[model samples]
Target chain A: MTTTNGLPPTGKSARIELVCPAGNLPSLRAAVDNGADSVYIGLRDNTNARNFGGLNFELPAARDGLDYAHRSGTKVLLAINTYPQPATWQRWTRAVDTAAGLGFDAVIIADAGLMRYAVRTHPQLRIHLSVQGSATSYEAINFYHRHFNVRRAVLPRVLSLAQVEQVIRNTPVEIEVFGFGSLCVMVEGRCALSSYVTGESPNMTGACSPAKAVRWEQKASGLEARLNGVLIDRYGANENAAYPTLCKGRFKAGDDVYYAIEEPASLNALELLPELDRIGVAAVKIEGRQRSPAYVAAVTRVWRQALDACAQGTAAPQPRWSEELRRMSEGQSHTLGAYHRPWK
Target chain B: MKLALGPLLYYWPRQSVVRFYEEIARSSVDIVYLGEVICSRRHELRLSDWLDLAAALEAAGKEVVLSTQALTESESDLRTLRRIAGNGRFPVEANDMGAVNVLAGAAPFIAGPHLNVYNPHTLSVLAGLGVRRWVMPVEMPRHVLEDMQHARPAGVETEVLAFGRLPLAFSARCFTARRNNLPKDDCRFSCIDHPDGLPLDTLEGAPFLVLNGIQTQSAHVHCLIADLDDLAGLGVDAVRISPQSRHTADVIALFRQRMIGALDAAAAARELEQLAPGATCDGYWRALPGMTPPGNAP
Candidate 1:
């Protein structure tokens, strides 16, 4: 059926794909039921993007998820995004080998050295450049494509639509842009602030704002969480507080205290589907593999419907769904950040 | 070991940029990287101006390397990279892969810290592509660099960002421009106002990070004055000193004295602390958390 926007039904006729995250079995089911043309997941351990507690899939679980998605005519992309440390390249190398041997549709990667290794060893495996690579320009994107034969690039969150269009115009690789998720204020893959405070490199370790160092303490004025002995943020009793990731923390500029880089908000760019499609983005990515199954279902359902409507050229009137998203978000707020000029 | 004065990561006046190099020509620094690294918009020194400065430094018996911008946002940026790569007079420090592609096999070049050359294999690849020197990524521990050095291709000189506020990350969204409520394209060169960098403090007024346009740097200047022996043990060829706003030339002199045993480690460490803009940290060298200053050097 066509959406009010006159877009074709999501799976039936759209050129663009709706890519969703599946951290586990239930999230996998939620993503498929909600309307993901494809779901990306990682094997539990340091091999995946969401290398946190209570998330990710085991090998058997990943195998089941892959088979389930394939049976349902959906795709499964494996994320091997983190760089391999000197002593630990074998772990990442094996993850790539496993993902290739297990029939993943594509394996997303961020490390240049690992990309070279994958291209040389697993020549037939499809490689998608991870956003963590921070390939923001046409030249950067083309460099990866020419060198590694990358089939797609998950564009960094920092690009404007105009820049995205320029990149697509100049490069042959398919483009994937973030559609829903907690937006990173800092450029992904390149940031070392978290590693500075804590010792884990997000690029090498697949963790940022690592939980091992996060300490939530209740004080008389409010609640404070220290990330590596530095007080990242504080929230009053009535205020909703998110996990104090380094870039999202409150800071003082001069006399003013504000979220210097970002406030706690999830990026909901569902309304920009038509703009994204017009820019020739080959796929739309939803960014919460560590979130709950319910979260995955709700977000995936909304965007799947939105993408379907956009394809039919009759996207629904902008839904007043901020309240619904706020309930799903970390700080009870959401934004369309950098995608539109929201900074003024 | 020799010292290379890294590119000025801060915005200094045109005169200050020239004067800093002029001082460096007579100073103990053996190599000087001259160019704008933090933001391409901070154009106090254009290509011609930088080349002129490079020529002056070269004339005064110093090796010069032109550094490419760590973050390239436009076609104009690629043009700049191409120009620097083809300059023919001096080596180029390939900060990003775009520059790497342009410089690969053309000539021997220095791979700057941001290229993320974490291991021997990556170094081997770049070495094959003609990287004559590779700067250690800012936070790599001493042991990791030692391991990589052992397996490094011969003639691949290793340089470490031994001093400076470590450049943590670079972005297309300019934080310094955003602080002024300006779009990156119309930044109006606001980063120039803060000659060192715009210091970002925690809500409680703790110094955290310094914002330099698109680049984010550490609040604490990374000082390896006390760890020179360890670095030399790793066979590091050169220690890169990033230029700060004040007392940079003095800091270079102190580093030279310490490296040559003219000053003891304790005296050098004390001098470094006195000269720093803020607290000093060398945890990256020790493999502890980068913000933690190790109590004693190994």
Candidate 2:
């Protein structure tokens, strides 16, 4: 399955790009100052997946952020990843036009029709397939590359290390894997769990488990978390409470009640830097465009150091790096996610 | 107004699967989607076995479709998908884009619900690739579908999920195996014991989701027999009813009766509630939480 398309000849020769998230102007600055090679941001509209309130860049802020990132030698990528409805398809195309016109480094897209528009109307804009595209296999990635001229494809956090290497070996498109962030148990773009509970989903609305649908009531039984009146989880008086993302909530399966789908943990693949670099992955992405600037700075700083150490062949588990990332991670814990087989 | 049976999402024993389809051969379903859409490891029925059943269903005047898996990771999985794409006998239901790529110009196919077609532009693109019909994603509300139906490409048909548990999500990790405390590689085919999938409930013991191998489905069945007139008004071509371990024939017959105006929607809904494995909900149809009752929505 090996192809000699874009593989780095040696591990040391590859310079794995560190891609960070920016939801606001300060976060964009934090990523750039902390040594991000590229910063991806979404617009204020629901055109992108992280359509949270008071987050994302308006037109003026986006222009400022783009100027700042480019001035600091950091590439700015526009994320117009959500599927555009019939009446609003023009909005998505306009977003692509805006990004290309404003000189954003690249535009990450998911929908096939939008990809066609990007390729046809703005052919020179470098296209990156967002994880929302759900192209888990190299064949799928190759389909997008062949049809849309996508330069890079962010692999979903579902493949094992060996499977990812297989995809990297097969496709000429650059592979980007998630390096650190809050984990999604379900495959991106394909999951309907949130919509089933709240009618808004990442595919249609660019939001999952929307805050408006969430209700945290101090019931007599315990601290109850409900999504649109359906019970998601309940914590005892002494137990710590976490945000009620549908997948991370505890549920009763078979003989016991527990976190049946997934635990409240973040994915930290800092330890896999050497392997990712060796695998010819063009980028390692940090997921969370809705966090504080401090969270962005801390994560970008740690990942930058780790990727550098791996390139110098001095990479090893450092207590300080792990401690810092743990503090910023969801639930103060992390897993290797699907990059490790046992996690599956 | 047409009824199509969705592909079975569970791994049943060989005899039960054969017996179930043998009965479906004589049922009133117009189209039958046949194959493994959940986990590739569920080898109770391989491609040949599915083809045999497809032939049997076709012999009884049913349109048969071979469905590909939702998550294709292994090289062997791709090989299976390629074979299905090239089957040539039956129309294929593509669950992922890889399947769509292989089947693009070869022949026409049906877009499975997992393909995530939320907009008319995406539907038109798939229609250009020879998609004759596109299944609506289960969680899409009626308003969105109305807009898509208005602008959908000519000759492209729309199908809605009418009955059975709504498949909410798919993951690489097998929750069924995880429930049994086993790794996915050596899952021991544990899903065979539960023909309808193992139910997962909230801590307070309310039915929530069903864990069927790698796929998670709503514990409540998504019945739209009451919305038959609305679907027809919107020009929907077909309605799909997912298979269950018990009472699938009765469920299909009820929907058929209601579709023909022989049975009232209220009476059909009442009967279906009794026959369904769990309570019924249509919140997603009304643009609210899926678990919300149809009457509770604004």
Task: Output the number of the DockQ-best candidate.
Answer: 2
Q: Residue A324 lDDT in model 2?
A: 95
Candidate 1, A1-344: lDDT as tens digits:
55444544233123679999988999999998888999999888786668888788888998988888889999999998876678777998899999899999989988887889899999999999998877877777777888889999998787667667767778888999898888887668778887788887777567888988989999987899889889899999987778878888888777767777777888877777777777678999999998889999998877776777788888753555545666787676777766775441
Model 1: which docking level applies?
medium
TM-score of each: 0.94, 0.97
lDDT of 1 by residue, B162-236 (tens): 888988887656788778778877888888899889999987788999888888899898988888998888898
* lDDT score, candidate 1, position B105: 81
In terms of lDDT, the poorest run of 10 residues in model 2 chain A is A3-12
Clashing pairs in model 1, backbone N/Cα/C closer than 3 A: A5-A313, A5-A314, A5-A315, A6-A312, A6-A314, A7-A311, A7-A312, A7-A313, A8-A312
lDDT agreement with native, every candidate: 0.83, 0.91
